[model samples]
Target chain A: MNTNNSGHSVDIVEVTKTFANVTAVHKVSLNIRKGEFMTLLGPSGCGKTTLLNMVAGFETQTSGAIRIDGKDISDVPPFMRETGMVFQSYALFPHMNVFDNIAFGLRMRKLPAKEIKAEVERALDMMKLSGMEGRRVRQLSGGQQQRIALARAIVIRPKVLLLDEPLSALDKNLRLQMQVELKELHQKTGLTTIFVTHDQGEALSLSDRVVVMSRGEVQQVSAPIELYTQPANGFVASFIGEINALPKARCQKSGQDFRFEVCPEISLNGRQPARLELKDGQMVHIFIRPEHIEIAGPRHNGANIVKGNVAAHIYQGTHTQTRVNVPGIGLVELRTKGAAAIDQAPLGSEIALSVPLDEAVILPA
Target chain B: MWRQTLFWVIVSCILFYMTIPAIVVVMTSFNPGEILSFPPNGFSLRWYEKALTYPDFRGAFRTGLIVALISSTLALVIGTSFAFLVVRYVFPGKNLLEGILSSPLIIPHFTTGFGFLLLGAHLNLNQTLTIIIMTHVVLVLPFVARAVYVSLLNIDPNFERSAANLGASPFMVLSRITVPLIIPGMAGGWLVASILSLTEFSASLYVTASRTQTLPVAMYNYIREYTDPTVAAVSALLIIATMLILMAANHFLGLRKILAIDSH
Candidate 1:
């Protein structure tokens, strides 16, 4: 975390937006550093796209301020903001040829004829669309048209680039490819980029920092690994990845050590527990990763283990997922390595699930 | 099955009844005999020649062409602006404005014609080409505006927003994107206005001066005074001109596309 301030790339200061009587965004303040790729990730109507639009100046925030490169641009219209946007639908001009569409901004600025020609050629080359200059936009394939739209936006050399779910319309394979290409493009251009998407995978894979949002509020903003490994709250934990939460039955404390009686499946081992303080008979929640549970292991004394019948085993190619039913404890999921056939876990067969006591994290219920 | 057959037969008969007069007009235009009859004595081109050579008919044709051209172009400009304003902006009384603009379509042409005649007479503008053109603009503006309004509604506002985000000014978006995309609608509106202006009778009869008589007014005058095949020849010529205009419109801008916009 290089926190030694590089001047803020794009600053949204207490920005609020409202539509009619409904509030779309409320007092959202964030600072994006220069050359940083930040994504606003949330579901539809969560105001992620609304915030992006305000940054692009296509929308006016009800209050607060927005600035790009330290200049207040809250009142500037979209054309004067000098920001480029890639729309979700790749709104290429249907009547214009590819080269002309890319050159539209330069033409609007009344650039010299020769300069416009050279710049359009350079943009086409940058987008790997050199030979597609003369073709009409509608004749191009989806991916090719998407590139043309990118070229059209970047040719102006804007201060910031805003992408609103730019890869959403593509098929899965092309979407993956585009994600890599867009990340590379961001690095190459070093432009302050604000991407808006509802896809957690896209936000995690491409952004330098991801801002998770829910119900029109920022939930968390961190690096992808940090967000996944140590979520700030239960909502973030569930939203970022899968986690199995178990209810705590009791807790005991000695000096500075605290121990909790979690799921009926787990029991404490002999260890020095002489620190921390917690009351007994207190209910709590324990968070554990599915892969931490060990199946078909040799029995160890005093280990956190539970005996249960294998209710269901699903074959998922790289790993086998099993649902085990323990009496009075309900069902728990365990994902083990290798194929289901190789694991040889039959339905209704008795099995023992074991996990290290230290691996489970107890949180306030 | 029998009822279906009967319904289709009745529809076909009605269609034939509507087309019979047009058929008779064409037939009389080609009649070799001088008299205008239901069935032609023989087929010839002499009536066509007579209609073309007649000085009054030529004058009236020229007047109608000029009036139609001026009225249609002016109406298209004013009507499309109104349509865009109504569709895109939020202003007080927008609905009222739209209703007032489209009122001409609902009002009978004769009522509009007589109202305009009385207004023009009081304003010392009666029996003049300017008044005729003004009245045509009023009569045809509603059709043009309604056609263009439908087209504007179909276009996604995001397209304009994308253009704005790409550094295009409002004027630039209108010229480079909006106008070109809505051209099919504009053409349809222009064609309808042109046809209406060309064949305008009730309004033109009230406003047209003796020297500025249009084709329909001239045809009315000629029919009342004479019973000759030349009148049918003139009517046939007018119908042919209309057909040619429609074919040209279709060839350049597909009629299906224009009709689709208008219907919406």
Candidate 2:
């Protein structure tokens, strides 16, 4: 990885925030590299926005410190912190025209009139809003207003650009379009960005590193692929995507592989993970994505085959999700490619499903 | 259709009943005769000319305008700060403070006038512009506070955060964002308070020793002492001035837009 080492890096150390009797953030520590796109992903009321606000200096942390570059900014006010933010509501000044809204920061800095006009024009051009400099904000659509909000923030060339779910107001198609534009904008400016969102798809797609937060603590901080493939815990796994969880499985080590008895008449062999230690007769749960399960032939030769009947077949646009009911084991959902599973595995038909050892993840029950 | 017709009839009747006295007074201002009468003998500008040139009437009109201007301006400032405190902060006695500030609007005007009369004498502040302006501010501050508070509530709180993050200091955010957005409400408050102060009579009558009577008080005293068309002419001019002020205010800040605070 080529990490840029020469820009503003935010270091949040053991920060805890509380509002009256409720603790919003608890001892959260994170390091965002210079010029890296870091995302805080969580549900509502999970303190993601609170953490972003603390970094932007809108809310002071109850305890601990936040540093930008090598200097501590705990005492600095928001205006002095030199961080630009796009709010969730896209809070553009309704009284000002597009040019004045984007030129506000430059005017606040007391820049020369020529410089202010030049900078504002450049920002407008960059945001594809060059001809809209004279338009009132109230006349703009939601997408146009969103672009103006970004233009206003980026015109200042702040040390770190903070976005608080700036795309949440757009429609689905517009949201996808803006998501692509946001990634391109990040690459073009190469500014350190901290984004807060509740959408896991947005976090996984736009961020260099994703921080999954639950309640008031960070559950895991990893790359998108690592978070999807090797989640740190049950919360991270379920939050990132769908998975079939087989709890109450007993495991026994056999050489390099471990045999797991998932349920009555359903014994399966799997390789033990190198990082996790296991003992004989230990209770564990196995998680596998529905797409990883495959249909085995009647005379299957693999040691992972199990006999079950196709209970249901749900036809999605690009794929079919089939639920197979094993006599001893519970219903196992399998995703098969487009319209194929319906003809092959009709309802109430006997079928053989195979669970590959490498695709299954074993966790302590 | 019958209900609609009856509604229109009743509305027009009420309107005519409310406006006939003012129409009669305006018509008397144009009376050619010296005595004030509903139907004039002939049209003339003699009474308007006399009323404009009258020294006491001129002095009273000037005093009323100046006092209203200074007092309403002060009331706007104080009421806006009070609104900020009530909307944005939490502290002891907040509700109590609001209740006390709004007491003048609830209490009888004559009772308030008598109360201020005793206070002014005790403080040796009678017959002074300071006391008059102070009293007018106290009387009209509730209107300003209510209008400004409604506007403040309608403003999205994120706008301030966005400004702060864009490198604006607290004072700059206030001057650049908060104040400009609420100016419509402030203008509404100023106009209502100033008009009310200009027409104030009971409070000024009780407080003014000799030199500081408002226009309404001077008009009342003049009508009691003598009978002529001069007073009607003065009333006509005051009405025209008020109409002009309303037009100017509407031109600057839409009157309907400012009063639409409750809808927001």
Candidate 3:
């Protein structure tokens, strides 16, 4: 029914899912643009998978509707929904060869054998699995199975592509490689892909737009960069990446700038062009990323300097994470580049930390 | 060294305890003497010929085969569907249904047979082939259901979901995915049910009349009346047949998988 080379758009409106007494997904609605690669990212039990299942029609919503290309299909059964999904287990028929597995959807549609074979071959070729057509599903390695699963889902070329943690099964290196292949496949097919995963890294790297969900509700739906930089709440801030939260920091409005006082001795200055949503002396929480904070010069005295002792230094290859315990603030983590910080900032050494509000978010306490 | 020797001696004694009766029956069946005796005057196939050629034995054997075939097949279909239901959906009284079906295992075959006999008599279908087949189906349904349940449990639920998501109806998912994947379990269950139904003596005795008696019931009758090695011959044949079928099942279907002994 779809003649466009680009994908059919999906509109999920006020979708809520409940299992018995437990609500897995609350009244959450999202609009996915045609050919856009969207990911539902959350921790386990955050209802990301439930929302994806609703879109694929595996799990129907308690209320509300899902539309494909402006047509509502909430009451449609999964088989009639015509949305292709790649499960977490791959779910390739263990009894069939790779070719048959990929051709299964086409065969289900009663497509001509010649056309089905051509499409399967084309999919296999795109996934770089040309010679694996005759191989059994169990024979393929984890990465190859992943590729075949992708090939199978995309070969159908349905209204939307659903992936349920497809890369979680692979080892780290293979997962990274498959992530690239997945991105390229999306570009080639232009199918409106709805990817569901709990890993923040995969969500950040793969999705055009990432939906950060928590506690059965959509915390924020934005591009990956915006999700990281401008998280709507405390949950989104901590979930997307590591950040330090200064709880109950009383804010004061002073002309064009804002100074947040943590204690009599320690204060943070907000010069980041102001969200300007806070009132004078409003109790708020400040969020600053690990990468933005730097070890301030000891002689530096002013609004943004805070005294702390180096608590720990975790040496990662790219960047060493330095933890500082400010008296008013709890353990504040900083991602200082290279191993220089490890030698420079030893344990229990008093350090003056510079807190940058350039990317910090302040929310009402 | 003494501990190892003691363990081996104990194992050998247990093995002898288990298999000596079968060895004696197999040996006794070949006795050249008309009367049943072990270490016979000379080995002869006379009893085997008699066991094969006797009219009543022949008729009983036919009945047993028919009953076993029909009952096992019926059990296979019912049990596989029931297994699918148990694995897929949860409803009220599910455990109760499972308990009632599997009660035949611990209910004593004679009691089940007696119950069936009473039902058949009340329906005025006493000792008929249909009644006997129905009895065997109820008796063997539990084993078939358990085997298929183990198999269905082993299968990834995603396979069916994946099929349904791929534009296949529930029936298509059953036909294309569920049935094919659990076929080994079905075949294994069917074979076991057939064997159990064939050798079933107490139930067969209660359920069948003289005209529709099964092999084991006929063997029981011959044992009481005639002092001959024919029953031994029949038993030897059955033992060998069952052993071969089980071994073949183990080789082909991985009996350990169906029995869930090793689980892998």
Pick the TM-score winner.
3
TM-score of each: 0.88, 0.88, 0.94
lDDT of 2 by residue, A260-311 (tens): 8887788888877645788888998788889988888656677888888999
DockQ of each: 0.44, 0.49, 0.57
Considering only N, C-alpha and C atoms within 3 Å, which residue pairs clash in candidate 2?
Answer: none
RMSD, one per candidate, in order: 4.5, 3.8, 2.7
- Local error of candidate 1 at residue B105 (angstroms): 2.1
True contacts kept of each: 0.54, 0.74, 0.76
lDDT of 2 by residue, B1-264 (tens): 999999999999999999898899999999998787878888999989988998878889889999999999999999999999999999999999899879997887777777788888999987888888888989999999988998899988888888998989999999999998888889888998998899888888887654778888888888888788999999999888888888877775654343332333
Candidate 1 residues B54-168, lDDT tens each?
A: 8888999999999999999999999999998999899999989988997887887888878888999899988788888888999999988987887788776766887888788
lDDT for position B93 in model 1: 99
Q: Clashing residue pairs, candidate 3?
A: none
- DockQ order, best first, reads 3, 2, 1
Best by DockQ: 3
- The regions of model 1 sitting more than 4 angstroms off are A1-8, A245-289, A293-296, A299-314, A321-334, A341-343, A348-365, B1-20, B254-264
DockQ of 3: 0.57
